[model samples]
Target chain A: MTAPQDNPQPKLGIIAGGGALPARLASAAQTAGRAVFVIKLDGHADDPALDEYPNVSTRLGAAAKILDAMRANECRDVVLAGKVARPSFSAIRPDWRAAKLFMKVGMKALGDDGLLRLVGEELEREGFRLVGAHDILTDLAVSEGVLGAIAPDDQAISDARRGLSVARILGQADVGQGCVVQQGLVLALEAIEGTDEMVRRSAKYRREGVGGVLVKASKPQQDKRLDLPAIGLTTIEEAHLAGLRGIALLAGGTMIIDRAAVIARADALGIFVLGLGDEDGETNHGV
Target chain B: MTAPQDNPQPKLGIIAGGGALPARLASAAQTAGRAVFVIKLDGHADDPALDEYPNVSTRLGAAAKILDAMRANECRDVVLAGKVARPSFSAIRPDWRAAKLFMKVGMKALGDDGLLRLVGEELEREGFRLVGAHDILTDLAVSEGVLGAIAPDDQAISDARRGLSVARILGQADVGQGCVVQQGLVLALEAIEGTDEMVRRSAKYRREGVGGVLVKASKPQQDKRLDLPAIGLTTIEEAHLAGLRGIALLAGGTMIIDRAAVIARADALGIFVLGLGDEDGETNHGV
Candidate 1:
């Protein structure tokens, strides 16, 4: 690591969860010449790389302590990254701040996005600027066009479009953010079971000749600062295992974690990885 | 078995698929003093009890043979029962009539319900009245209110309501007909993998204290004569295995195969079996 700068940029505070994205984001921020402080959410964030940075391991529901820790480290910019399974309300032992926020939002009534927005708003109220991991790590945001050696064939493209349409419908319902479409029929829709399980289930319905496409997109009313749709090498591997022809994600709206590795895996598997633009209206007919 | 009647209400032709519903329907029809002729769809209809009735085993896509066989038995009313896997268009070796029907419907563009309706219409054109199994077996139609000994707890009732709402949205989308919801979060949505698989998958997402409810309903635009959702004893067993608290069916719109046995199984498993009415608007709110 380079010697500490005489005057560093505002420290980026990461409320890390499971998976490699949080650590990857920290590295990206550090490389961008910004000091970082990480607060790993206990039982969720388990990356050892976080130890290399100034960090504190804290349990979920300790929102007040988290705010205090970030304040102590002089972190004015906070980014929430990685997966955090929604715990049962009874399991939560929230601090005063979190409790107040929960009371205001009516914890039981809030959906995934609702809870995220409430957290973001609460953080903002304390003078912290909520930042998406993509804001600091721009390379992780999927760009326009296909990203792997294999381009989606006509059938895959059609399936991708169908998948996107279904996903949009699902998002509008605030149900889920991903789906698999095959031969113009929806094979599976991601719910609380998550994407990998959805892909696995879709495999059972795979046809002999036609392959499906997995589409992931941010919810229509989602708060981009928190819980943006994301995929990594594991997603590519899962798609391959599910006998899918390709994976399509909303361009600039989804995070492509470990972009190079994900692309490499897709290329090796001969599965296409295409970043779909929002303007691409539904034209495919079958599904 | 009773001797063949002189003029048996124009033998009810049963287009059978997998499951006990076909056999049950045959028994019900016979008990109602109507001779039954079973045209078992190959690979799907495997019930051994079919041997007890006058039956002809035939492949799907052999629409001409099916029509001829039903006519040979002097059948005027037909009931399509159980499940038929959607065959690939290339794999379908449809006779002249089915081919013409497929061409007119644009087989590639039609959804599950669309194809079913076309088939029903074509059978009507052939002077055969397509009948739902429930019409012959009145006991198979789920009655309003709880069927099993146990009643759904407040939470299960809420989850059932939520599941029904989601199922309706999925139905409107022309997707699958069932879903599992627990504590207000959708655990799984039935797609091509079917209800059993969906229930199995939902088991993975089950929380420590709360169980889910599986809701199965008919599609909004579904051809009631062709594909009404049906649950059987196996469904009750699956729900119990999946740790679900109850099973909910759309009253009057769904078929309850082997009603007594299903209720007995559910009661033994200590799970509620409730038939939901469409008019029961969302009132319970503690899923």
Candidate 2:
């Protein structure tokens, strides 16, 4: 196995999925003075903005072709960003390399994180260093403290803590990463349908006077490089739609994509966007 | 306190909520040759069918009036049936008896089961015996077998087991009692929004070739006399609409309101409705 080069300008590969995160990662890599090579996942990466980068489009199961493209561009470091819907087993038409890896991992029943770790190991075995998008775009990682003018009140803070605790439990089961808690009661839990829909469904359960809080956190045993928990402008919009008082994300464990836009939107909606620290003991409003 | 007499015909009281279950329970109790009295919860019981029985309408927090009405008719055995939405704290205008009980139980922070237990204790103190709705309506209890011709395939059974396990975990937390699982992945967990909406949302997460299963079970520590898990014709309809292959419910623990209608609907939709036994070991697809 080869170690990643200590060269100041190592070539970076971006495996782009749907959403703005991939393009942001590409832009960040370019700004960091590194050569960028992008492999846009067919049917997932339809962003016309990605055309600005040097890229090739390929299907998800064509692992050999993806590796070949990366190697052809002399790329050593790789980052996977954005949303990739889990395809059913029948939908996977894996190439020889991917098929072998799938069989080795007992792909028939592996959860999301399990498949991700297997993919990471396969990438490392092919001599590519797996890096988190946060490595190149550090600003995307949420920082501790309130991100907007409004701060969560005592009730909202309590609900956020309850929500984060439930999320951890769900994460431990390898099920989900987000939930909405209102007045210390869990109103909704995110599963395969994703966060936006969960937020939308929470509207029916919202308390008469008390608003809920949305909590998104990384899984306890997740591969950070593959799929860190993320929230963006859509999250703020949805939270507002759900009549939630705030959004609480795990600090240093979640990605806040389009940070500036998120904060501005949260401020306009009078919603607090808080980045909770590791300790769940006390909530310092930090007004 | 008066011990309930084992007399030939002790009058039964039915605290009715929304839906056909209350009316069905009233009919069943009447058929059993017991005099029936009903206290319909104001907002929840809109069924005109309940008018067939001698009944009085009262608000949720008017416990004194409910008890008075029951005792006025010499009713001793009581059954709470159907759906009652959680009222906000400020909306609860409890009478003296309910106020005392609420203070004794710290009702403001209690979960659904906790509050139900406290209410049961209060009723017992007033010489009323709280009985499960199933006790009077034995036929409403789901039997251990598939209710329709179609059976859950191996994948669907596996998902049902997975969903039931997750639902148990959520139940232990006093959170939810239902979940949708497809191809070994949990699609959604029922929380405050109720079962029908959860089933609707699961439709968005259904896999390409494999449909999911809805699992409803009793919370491990819940009171059997209060809020037992229930399903009705609406469940079968929603499960079909969600593209679910089947429904798995805990036998003897779940109420199947309008059983004949439910079974007919499941058969017409080609959906399996299996009553899972206490042991989650094997799925007996008794067609």
Candidate 3:
């Protein structure tokens, strides 16, 4: 093995899942003058943008192949990016490594966060340094304050605060990451249905007068390296279609995918995007 | 105010909401030779069966009218039956009684159970004893063990156990009443969108192999007198369409609206209807 001093900045290996975030992270690493390798998850990492990167496609359960691909490319720093859905217990045909990991966690890994933690641990134990996508794309993390031209009114802000607490409780239970609150009533919650579907369902339960606010946050015991809550232009479109007035994301904890485009769409649609203060820091009522 | 020695049982007052339970309760009370008065929730209690009952239709916020009618008809016992969606803060134009109750509970009443408790307290304070629908329709209360011809297999029973805990946590938070679990993965949770919608949403996320199980239970701190989780033909139809294998409801804590019809339909559709044992009593894992 080469001395640790031989390569202070090792090649980054990105295990790409579904969405544009993985492609963006790969680009960011290249822009930083560092070589990168991409392990595209079969049936999930279908984004054409990933084609430009040096990558190999493999099934999610093929852990041995994934580890070998990263090692062959001389990648030591690994980043798991995008959305990797929690595989149903019977659906996953785990490799030896994956089977071993599952044996350790068993049914506890059935939860989304639990499964991610197991995957993160496996990667670390294989001598690969786990890196969060946000580490490479700093600008993508939501900042504390309002985005776009629209600022939430008192009513919207109040709804957002209620939604924040509800979202946190959901996360704490490891049940969901977001919820839509309208006029102090929770309209819809994100379970396995996901955020976009939850947003769509919220439209059916909206109250009179004002629309709801979409609140997104990381779970209290979240492993940030895996599945940081994210929003993009599609989120803006869905929220608009669902008649939501604004979006509230936990500042520094949520990822704003294509921030400029998302903000521009929100501005055009007259919907506010407010970054709630860190849960560990001062309470951000958007005051 | 007649003396207690004058008459033993006063007329039963049912503040009817949506669904068949109100009408069923009305019939059950009449069959028992007890006089019944129904206060039909206008725009909500639209069941044609309710037309035969001695009733008055009033807006949800018109608590004074509802109470006055109940008093005029000498309804000393009240049962808040059927589904009442928590009204948006601005949507409710509360009368003196409702306004006072809201002022007392503040936004605490925003939750389903909280709102029911407030309504129950107001009824008690006004000298009417609150009754549960299950108390009126004794046969409707689900009993332990398999209800229909088809019994849940071990896999289905395991899914139900996982779902029961998830549903309990959701209830403890006053967020929902049910959840769908498939192959050890939570597919959907019922929030303001209600149980049928949650069941419908679960279909979209079903994994391969065995279908999911729908588990319905009263919230951990559920005010059983108000909204004990109820299911009927509609629930059966929805679950069947969603490709669910069976349903497990909290025994004695959930009301099976038209028990015979629900069972017949479940048997006809080849789906098992299992009643989990009472939460406070024996652990009924369907072993």
Candidate 4:
């Protein structure tokens, strides 16, 4: 696989997904002296921002264009960043290349994980190294320890651990990346409904029965550029509605869109935010 | 603790919750020449029909009543059988005994295993021995081999194994006893929301291009007779909508409620059903 020349700066491929993280990762990579090859999405990403990253060539591509974009730029590693409004099955418009991918891989492949894993393999077959987002930007990786003044009670800690485990299982299979746990029981798991809905649903558990722990983590063998599990100020705000005690993220694999803002919100809400360390730190769905 | 008299038949304590299982257990025990004690439930159990057992005694109380009835009955072996609606936070009417229990145990103690462990300890303290339902009705325990004519595909089996682990974790934690898995990814984790909701809500995954496998199990410390996870005709129906491929449940330990009916439904739906031999089962939440 050809590595983008050690121009003291790498050309990274950002396979942007839905959300603000893709844009953030774009700017971060550029600032760090790396050019970005962005696969700007339709519903999931704001395309107008393409003008912001000049050296970063952008394409609103179908599958062929996507692979071509990465190959043409001689990109080193790819990262999945951001959220896109996940269209129901009827909505996914797979171009011929994407369609061919589906036919080659077949419907039997697992969910998001399968889609990513297959594409990653295809990219490698054509010569592109797939790098986990966690391996890059260690400086931006979540730092371990409570990022707030308050600490979790015993129950919250237990919930957080369990939540992390469940979330990882979901991640490993590419179902979702977050879970709400309370008193050792899982309350809700995020799917297309997303994180905010899960937070609102947790309110039902609040009647002193069993409170919840919210955990978000990265999946095993996951590509970081398309959709790095992220949390921001809004996540903190949602957690407050149901009195979530602990908020957990994968130390290296996950992104906090605005770390300072998230921490500040957590501090204000008296919620505990923690970046669990790597490898074992992230829960594997044991698939 | 003192053991029961050396009679061939043992004395059984029916720590009834909200289901018909306790009465069924009592009838079974009496037929085997044993004595029975029915600890009636306040909100969950149907009080009238429990009078069938000749020596049955009833008491309406919260979680604490389970232990007390076992002690009063002078029964050496006790089975906690039946369901209690998940008490909303406001509905948690633990008496002084249960209140004391809550005050004493922390979050770790709240896990399903912990709660059952506590129940087992409390019974031991009161000189009652807690035994598995399978021990009493081993005939009812589902066998390990596939129950229906057809076996689930490899993928469904994979999903089943994954579901088993997740179900065990949730069950051991005293949360809920069922989970739906697909392609090695968890589609739903049951909590107070229960099994039915777990199935219905799985539509999102079906649309995401993956069907699911369903699993139900008893906790390691599960006491039989009360709230053993029971799946019946309705389960198969729900699985149909969610595009489930297989269903697994503990054999002897779990009740199928209407076994024949559930299996028939599964047969028609092409959903594989296996009464997994007693690795355990628990409270089924849901609509």
Shift in Å, residue B253, candidate 2: 3.2
Between candidates 2 and 4, the DockQ winner? 2
- Candidate 2: tens digits of C-alpha lDDT, residues B153-194: 777777777777777666766777899988667778888778
What does candidate 1's lDDT look like per residue over A52-85, in tens digits? 9999998878988999999999999999998887
Which candidate order results from sorting by lDDT in descending order? 3, 1, 2, 4
* Separate DockQ for every predicted complex: 0.32, 0.31, 0.37, 0.19
lDDT of 1 by residue, B1-287 (tens): 65677766767999998988899889988887888899998889989999999999887788889999999899999988888776666666777867877778673444445566677888999999988887888888887898989998887887788778778767766778898888777888887777888899889887776788999998766777786998887888899999999998888778888888888988999999999898663633222
Which 10 residues in a row give candidate 1 chain B its minimum summed lDDT?
B278-287
Q: CA lDDT of each candidate?
A: 0.82, 0.81, 0.83, 0.64
Which predicted model would earn the best lDDT?
3
lDDT of 3 at A26: 88
Q: What tens digits encode model 3's per-residue C-alpha lDDT throughout B106-133?
A: 7747755677777888889999999898
* Residue lDDT tens for model 4, A47-140: 4665566333333327677777777777877776566544433455677876777778665343445555566677677667666554555444
Give me the displacement of residue A30 in model 2, in angstroms: 2.9
* lDDT pick, better of 1 and 2: 1
The fraction of correct interface contacts reproduced by each prediction comes to: 0.35, 0.38, 0.47, 0.24
lDDT of 3 by residue, A171-234 (tens): 7567788989876677888887779989998898887557889999988778787779999989
How many Å off is the CA of A58 in candidate 2? 1.1
Q: What does candidate 4's lDDT look like per residue over B167-213, in tens digits? A: 66545434567777765545566665667787887666555555677
Candidate 1 docking: what grade?
Answer: acceptable
Q: After superposition, how far is residue B223 of candidate 2 from its true place, in Å?
A: 1.8
RMSD from true fold, candidate 4: 6.6
Among all candidates shown, the one with the greatest DockQ: 3
Candidate 1 reaches a DockQ of 0.32
